[model samples]
Target: MTTVNADAATPTELNVLVRPLPDYPDAERAYSRSSSLLWRRSAGAVEILHPWTERTISDSVMVASLSELVELGVLSGQEQFEDAAVQMICSSAASEESAWRAYYLNSINELDNGTSPFSPVHRRARSLIAGHEVLEVGCCFGFFALACARDGHSVRACDISPGAIDLLTTASASLRIDVDACVGNALALPYPDDHVDTVTLIHLLEHLDVQDTTVAVTEALRVARHRVVIAVPFEEEPTEHFGHLLRLTEDDLRLWADRVDHAGAEIFTDHGGWLILTPHR
Candidate 1:
């Protein structure tokens, strides 16, 4: 698979969320076993074609988590595949941080050496953090959680996808960053009530329904001693490619504030909708 720019200007450029396939023979062996799925580049987009089914795995495949991609036969599940991907990224980079930065820069066309798509939101989220102990709920790759750890916070991150958590744990260990990473759900987080100073759900609510979003916010509020921070993309329509089920707005965020008991609530926009709710003492 090839990593193409999501925002590539050309009409023919296939904009898809794909990682670079490992160059090693072991990875090649793993790819060969993937249900006869082949990446075919056409005029419009790169299609995952299954020879047996004679159909493309398109919108049906949720691109939300790494594991989902693996389940759709778009990625390999073998241990060697993971190791090879890690090795490929870490081969030439000076440090693990730089390696990840470079990977993001390539994966996301908008990202530069010093910035990512979430950098602005992360900066705001970091500033609003109540204390040093932080738990990032629904942390896909644990990038924000890792950022918090790097900034001197006791950070813990969790996601429902085991594959994503595994990748985060492996990368954290390789990066020499101490992050308590685990597999967890947003509606029912593994952490106890008031377990951390702050709980953040960055770019997570959009993927959930209204009811689940409420439950997740409640759960985050339950686990947070000081504050619960929620962020969602303010899109006109939900982006299906990224698995966003809901198009969130500031009013939707304020409704959470109305329903939950909080000492204070702040709703604003800095790249996207940000809601910071201080838990009632």
Candidate 2:
């Protein structure tokens, strides 16, 4: 998918939200098998998906201490997800497709339902925007994109996952927010140099395999005219088959900023490391 730049000289009008949704055949390959919710605090024990309500997930701090940023249209708002997830496990008969769906359903709700379990990425990026365009790479379900749009910034979101880009675009329209959502590669972003004021790779860089390391960062820097923000789990223990590829320390971010001749901060937080970098003069 392609983004229709609102400021393009020709002044073309595009209704991306009205476009047909992307069918994610790649979901099974992109899904995770292992569970990340063994000890997460919640209002109740595992239950079915259909009857579970949003209140069920966020009402209790046990699930997550944080509240979502906006209301989610996905959940039925009735039961505890844990029980429903197990049903999904059995319904799909423990197949890879079932595992992937269950994983995404849990993960998407975690971030998109107006609250996020992760933090520190937006703390500094918001201050630096100063009314500039924003690009969110790996913007799964576009929760943060919605937050930026809510804060009155023009936002564009991209992910390699066609399903993600399409869903986020659909949700933006439903919320009456204007945003350009598209399929983009982190290693070779489609944007031109200095195209956006700021670029964000929140919890994204570490997901790349060992070999694609520098390309994602280099591409982010190439596209940002003012600031580049990167956040990753600190001292992360790699997950099996489908999660983080490596752990990152403050020193790693410092070295990355130095490569661009820019000064940056290595903010160590309980949640993660938030790295904010600026362009060289």
Give all TM-scores, in the order shown: 0.66, 0.60
Writing each residue's lDDT as its tens digit, candidate 2 over 113-151 gives 435445334544555563469999888667677667777
Measured with C-alpha atoms, the lDDT of residue 74 in candidate 1 is 38
Q: When superposed on Cα atoms, how far off is each prediction in RMSD?
A: 10.8, 16.1
- Model 1: per-residue Cα lDDT over 14-99, one tens digit each: 33322333323344433332333334334454333222111211111212233333444334433422443444454325465665
| Alpha-carbon runs more than 4 Å astray in model 2 | 1-51, 54-116, 119-121, 128-130, 240-242, 261-270
> What is residue 8's positional error in candidate 1, in angstroms?
22
State how far residue 20 of model 2 sits from its true place (Å): 29
Candidate closest to the true structure, highest lDDT? 1
Per-residue lDDT value at 246 in model 1: 93
